[model samples]
Structure formats: structure tokens, C-alpha cells
Target: MNSDWQIELRALRYFICVAEEKSFTRAAGRLRIAQPALSRQIKKLEEDLRVQLFIRNSRGAELTEAGEILLRRAYLIFNQVQQTHHDVTIHSRHLGGVVSVGMPPTPGEFIAPRLLERSKERYPDIELRFVEGFSGELERKLANNEIGVAVMHDPAPRDDIRISKLLVEHLCLVGRSGTLAKPEYSLAEAGSYPLVMPSRPNFLRILIDGHAERLDIPLNIVTRSDGIGHTKSLVKYGHGFTILTYGAVISEVQQGVLQAVPICNPEILWTLCVAMRTDQGRKRTLAVIEELIQEVVQELVAEGIWK
Candidate 1:
């Protein structure tokens, strides 16, 4: 037996429409084709398979046993072909492929929604997988090819990554609302409260620790956890204060759960970057990263968090 792979999916689709509708006239209407053309495709399909596909009576055409079996198989064949074409087109045109990105949990600071919305409109079939973590973890994933792009603060040294600074802004002071009303507070004052900071080596933790060290002091960490939301929860419960890079703090500040103040005394600023794996580089991945970075920057800027 021989099979032709070159037949247009259009023919199989036309045949299925007629089989389901049971009327050439209705099938043609559904196919946006003349009735005669729809009939011809069905005839051609039956001839190709060397099988009778329909039995016509006064009421309407009904599928013969052969027609039922062929329709089932043809329906599946056409679906598989359509999906294959779709996948190939997306892979080639950057429309329907998958990309993995690492992001921090506090995604709201970046204008992520607008960027994702635009990406979907342009490439409706593209799949974006977001891996949420701090900058260090994200960079590790980028090196492993687990994520195509890492969107976080500028990473520490890693030979496998090539990073581009996308947004630079002062990391801010965040604490439970009403903790302190000062625009800038002394380290002693900032340390007076309990703190729910990330574990040592995490970006925020490192920043806070370095600042305290410079001031001849230390971070007054009440508890250490590994997640932004968990730290936020601690702040919510009045458990402790936490710091946020500008983008991380903006939305929480606006929501009134946390208040943000500018840090002073050897002021710290975080540079948000798009980190790409030198080994896993792909044009599609870069295109998506480029599209998202601007929106993230815009959001941070508009909220005055990244100023």
C-alpha cells in the first residue's frame, strides 16, 4: 500500500465537513466554497481510498460503514497534520514555540501583563514558562538551559551567562505599613525593627548585609526565608521588615500592605538585567526577552520605584 503525504489538509478537512454535515450544500457553506467544489473533494477522497463514503436517501446523506471508519481515521490524520504544520510554523516563524524565563516572585513591578499580552497577540501559540526565584537561582537555571532568559537583578559572576542591563533603580526600603514614616532612615533605626529577609547570599540579603557591613553593623534578621511572598507575609503579620529592589516593592507599596522608603547612606541601587545563556542562545528567546524588558522597565519607572 502507498500513502501520499503531499495531499493538502484542505482536502481531508473538506471531506470531514461533508461527512459531518451530511449535505453538500451545508458543507460548502461551512467550508466557504461552492457546493460543487465540496462534492468534488469528497468524491476525490472516496476515489483515493477506493471506498464508498456516503449513502443518499430522501432525508439526507448518511455515512456508510466505510465512510464512518474513513471519516474517523481521516479526521485524526488531518488533525495530526494540522498540528505538525502549526508546530513547524511556530518553530520557524517564532510564533508558536516555547520559551522558558526565570522571574522573581514579585513580578508586578515589571509591566509583565502588557508584554505577555502583546506576545500572545503576535504569537498566539507560543508557550512561556516562568520559573520564579531570586537572581542567583535564575542564573543557574539559565546556565543549565532550564530557562532561556533570566529576568532578575544583575547576576554575580558566572561564565556561562551573558547579561544585558535593562533597568537600573534604587533598591528601596520596605516594611510593614506605619513602621516608620521617614524618607530615609539611619541603619540603627532600620535595624531597630525585626526583619524577615532572604537567606544569606540571596540578592536582597546580600545587598542588605553589605550595606550593614559598610556601616560597621549587621542585618538584624529576625527570620530568614527564601521567597518574596513569604517575606511579604511576614511583613503583613508584623513579623519583620524586608527590603525590596525598586521593582519588587512598587506594587506592594501601592497596595498599602507595605510602605516603601528610599534608602540612604551608601545608597544601594539594583540593576535589573536579562541574562541569556551563552550556550543556549536562540533568536526566538532573545526576541521575547527584548519584548518583555521594556515593559518591565516602564512599569518600574512609572511607579517611581526605579527612579
Candidate 2:
């Protein structure tokens, strides 16, 4: 609200440090500036605002009411400036920089290795970090800017986020090898088998459960798992069957440790999406990474690695 006060950001920063520390000497020490210079900057700041910002004494300086107001506004201003700088820096980066991408455990396990290898081959200077978690967690990380982009599932329609459909992967019933003679199943028939499934709130579980609900069929879920590894382990050992996209169990199925049967009453499909903040939707790095992921997914699908 101090419209007439044309204050330098550096001086505002100095004033904030003094206000927070309540001691000019300590603030100057923290700022690595001479105490006298810090004092002059704060004094100039006060003159610009035409108000007493601090009650100075030998012991310390306490903020006046105006100082408190500036403190609040300055905090907001500095935060915005920092965020702008970060975004601008990211946008300005060329072929070399760090980017974080989030993915669910299943796709992450399959995609991360190929993505890293290809990135090393193509964009060797660009450092890549992959964060693997459930879709719910990945979405939260994307929203908070903890990740630059995410490969996730069922990205609901939202104003602040932009989603691109990368794949509509077919879900199949998986179990210990030789347990099922045929490699195809109706959702109703699949419901008869005991299931090992991720608990509710998991995207896969939600999708599977929704299908069951829609068909008025109850799944005989024998055990619950929050992790893809555990879910695969449970199915491999003949404990029970589980539903997942073919890419998730391709290796196991090929090794004869697990057999997959496509679910076909409605043909369960897992819709994978690449999601990013709408504001940064046009970022070059994001576009490159997204394109690479789509390429990898299509290659897998084409080669029958992911069905």
C-alpha cells in the first residue's frame, strides 16, 4: 500500500532480516554485510516509506507497526520474485539442466530405464530424475511443482492442469503360470477367482473396483497390497490373481512365472496420461520428455512388450 515509496528490493531484504532478527548486528552478520551499511540501507528504506520501521536501541531493534505491515508484504513479494526467477531459469535452460518427472510404480519401473538410456543417448547433458509413487502422490507432486511433469493415470479434468492421453493400455488377469488354461476372461468370470489387489485409493484398484461395481459383481479380493512389487509377488506365488496392464507383468509372463489373461467383458483399460501445470504446458523440456515417454510406450506396445 506504500505506493509512493520506491524502495530497492535489496534494501527491503535488508529491512526484513533486521525485523526478523530484531538485532541490526545479528542481521548484518547473517547477511554478511557491515553493520553500518545495513543500518544505512534500512534508514533509507524508512525514509522512502516516510515512517519509522524500527525502534533502535543498544540492545536491539523492534519493528514498528509499519515495519510489521512491510514484513508481511515483503514476504509475499520475495516469494513471488523467487518463484518467477525459478520459472524463468527453467524456461531459459537449453540442452543442459535438471528435470524431475513423476510416475506411478508400474509404469515407472518399465519406463524409467528406457527413458534414462535414451536420454543419455540423445540429451546426455540434460540430467533427469524420476520420482516413483502412486498416481495420487504423483499428482500432488506435480501440482506442488516438485516435479516438472508426470506420467499418471485417470488425470481428471481440471483447470490448472493439462493432460495428454499417452496410452489406453489393456488390463489383464495375472496369476501363477499354468493356473489358467485360457488367456482371456470376461470380467464376470474373472470375478470368480480370488484377487490380490491394491487397496482403495490406488488408481488401478479404483478402476478395477469401478468395473466390478458397474457390472454388479463382487471381486473376491483375498489380499490387499499398496505396492506393485508385492502385487506381482502375490500373483507369482499362486496366492491369487490380480488385474493389471500387460506392460506391468510382461517380464513375468514371458519367464513363465506368471500367466496373463486379458479381461474382456468390457475390456478393462488403463488410461495413462502425461500431466503438467497448464502455465508450463509449453515448456520445451517438458515437451521433449513427454514426447520421449510417448515414443517409448508406443515402441513397447508395438513390440508386444506392453499390450
Candidate 3:
């Protein structure tokens, strides 16, 4: 590649017009540029590339092979840039613009409970929408602007969105604070447990299943519901144990209702973050967002949830 290949779209367009018109006088008329300046820019473009892009004859100018090739690729690049601006403009203009929010299956799982609560409290008037999906789908929706924000596992955020670190969490093996002696737990050695985790086919469930397979143990679900309260209540009542994130059980942990045993083998460390729009908006928009995020982090920090 040429070192000076960082040419602008306008330059490519001027070249294309000159090539198509094949006449300095006529191309200038088509582009509304004075013939002399149009000639100078195209000349600079060719010089930067170290290639002659056109040949001048008695009648006009026509593109050489190099010019034709570059023109084709430039056309595609400019068209994509054009479409991106168009889409972003449309998103901000629509009334009651839809901001689809992605939810993790088990409500209040991970750092989700307080995050959701803070969002509602801070932006009570701002419309919020929710759709349940895994990290992968949520990333896609964020990229397409279908989902304005997502709460999920790390390493899935897109290039277009900004993320704020909230907590470092993991699935800890826990039972009602008192039952660590008899255990009767078989998979503890291989990182498996008869945990009341999200059901199969869900993202977290798939991750747990993979670990269990490697440990060569079966994960028997004593509680198969995707309700956060229900799963925590099950473990609190000593019906069974569950592997949940710090945010999922932080309150209970602090209250001594559910004590945690950090997973030793095949440990999982996950970071929770909040996703937000990158656009610089009026102070009103950012004020709400700032409070919402600050609340989640401060709440977790005050409770000593994240390490």
C-alpha cells in the first residue's frame, strides 16, 4: 500500500467526476468547481499515490488503469460513511425514540438488580424497553442501535459503544452459611455443583455445563427457575446450593443469610459494566445517565461487593 493512501472521499469524487466527464471544462461544470482547482486536487491525489491517474488529450482527460481501480473502491467507502451518518441521525430524531435495553434472563442476576433500579429512578420519565438475550445478541443490538444499552458478561462490548466498569464478580459456590462439613458435593473437586443456575441453552448455563463436562460430572438442577429471588430463596432455605455472582447475592451475603465459598477449581472471574450512548447530548441526558451509573457502583462499593 502507498504511504499517502489516506486520501479523502471528496478527492476521490472529484477524480471520478473528471474521469467520467473526460474534460476539465465539463467536469468543473458537473462538480461546480472551477476547472483550475479541480485540476490541482486531482493532480495532488495522483502525486500522493505516485501514479498518474489521467491523460490529457486535445478533447479532454480520461482515467488511467490505476485511477479506475481506486475509484471503484473509493465509491464503496464513501457510500458506507454516508449511510452511517444517515442511520445515527434517524435514531436521534424519531419521537419517543426506541432504546431497546437487553436483560439477562434471571432478573437481578449479576450487577443487574441495582443497575436496573438506578436507571428507573434516575430516568423515570425516560422510556425504557427490555428484551432478554445472551451477551452475543445484545452486542449485535447495541451495534445496530436497536438496544441502547446492555448488562452482561465482559469482552462482548462493541466498538461503537462506551462501557463503565462496575464490579468484578464470579459464580461462587454457596449454601445456607452452615452446611460446609458434610458437603456431599461430588463436583466440587472438578468445579461442578448441583447449583440452581439459569436453565440450559442460556449463556451462563452453557458456560457452567462446559465446565462440568470437563470435570466429568453431571449438574443436577434442584431449582430450574430463572427468577433471581427464587434461586436465592432456595439456597437460603437449605433446599440446595447455587453459584451466583457477587451482585446477585451481595445483600444476602452481608446479612449472613447466605455465606459464600469461592470456587477454587476452574475459577470464573467476570467484570460487570454499564453501556451507554457515545453521543454528546444536552446536560439533561447526561445528568440522568451519570446518576444511574454512579448509584450502581456506589451501592456495590458501599456494601463491599466488588473486590
Counted clashes in each candidate structure = 0, 0, 0
Displacement of the residue 270 alpha carbon in candidate 2, Å: 0.9
Residue 282, candidate 1: C-alpha displacement in angstroms: 4.5
lDDT per residue (tens digit) for residues 1-307 in model 1: 1276356677877877787678777888987999877778777777777778888777677999988776767745653553456545555644555566678766533545655776677667766655677778777656655566778775776678877777676766678888867888666567666777777788767877777877887667789878787887888778878777655666667788788777766677777777776754445545665666666677657876556
| Residue pairs that clash (backbone atoms under 3 angstroms), model 3 | none
lDDT of 2 by residue, 83-191 (tens): 5655777756555566778988778877889999988888887779777888888887677666777999997788888898888988888889899888699998888
The lDDT values for all models are: 0.70, 0.83, 0.64
In the order shown, what is each candidate's alpha-carbon RMSD?
Answer: 14.3, 10.8, 17.2
- For model 3, where is the 10-residue window of minimal lDDT? 279-288
Off by over 4 Å in 2: 1-93
Residue 110's C-alpha lDDT in candidate 2? 75
Better of 2 and 3 by lDDT: 2
Candidate 3 residue-wise lDDT, 112-189, digit = tens = 567556666655545555667666567665555445566666734455677777566666676787765442333454
User: What TM-score fits each model?
Assistant: 0.64, 0.70, 0.49
Cα error, candidate 1, residue 218 (Å): 2.5
Residue 93, model 1: Cα distance from true site in angstroms: 4.6
Clashes of 2: 0
